[model samples]
Target: MTAYAVGQLRNVQMNDGIVDYLHGIDATLAPFGGRFIIHGGTRETLEGSPADDLIVIAFPSKAAARAWYVSPAYQVLVPLRLQGAEGDIYLMEGVGSEHRATDILDVG
Candidate 1:
């Protein structure tokens, strides 16, 4: 199944560290079949608090996503991302085509 690395960012600090992180991220992603689906584009919040930015990257599978996140090349960039932004990052498993919301919910 496809998996995603989603980040909700705030308090972004644009600096040399972030520039280095941006420059090196693509190379790290290529080896794991990861691609950016969303990278801080425009957003509209329907409710609740809003984030400064949102990022989502898709990987072939959860394992691939995990591999990319922990790889040495990526690990080196981790501190830069943390220093540049305050946010939450999550690894989410995508649902298969056969999935149905009703199947997991009590419709009663």
Candidate 2:
């Protein structure tokens, strides 16, 4: 089954080096089968607090997600993301077509 990794980043203070970091990071993700499903979009907080940015990326699989997270190439960008923002990142197993009905049934 495919999986999707969602990142919720809150940038307290953005510096000028972010562009360079993103350029390199984007290329690095391709090795591990990563795709940018959502980069930055308009968001509204329906409930709790609000965040600065909402980043959502999708991976080919859970293993791909894990590999991309810990890969040395991507690891170098960690400091950039940390210094640029503070947020939570999560990975969730994607529901395939087979499970679509189950998801609806469960919701019902």
What TM-score would every model get versus the actual structure? 0.88, 0.79
| lDDT by residue for model 1 (26-75), tens | 99999999999999666788998775688999999999999999999999
Could you tell me which 10 consecutive residues in candidate 1 have the lowest summed lDDT?
43-52
Best by lDDT: 1
Residue-level error in angstroms, candidate 1, position 46:
2.7
State the lDDT of candidate 2 residue by residue for 43-83, as single tens digits: 66799887557677788899999889889998888887776
Off by over 4 Å in 1: 106-108
Per-residue lDDT value at 28 in model 1: 98
* Residue pair clashes in candidate 2: none
Which candidate ranks first by TM-score, i.e. highest?
1
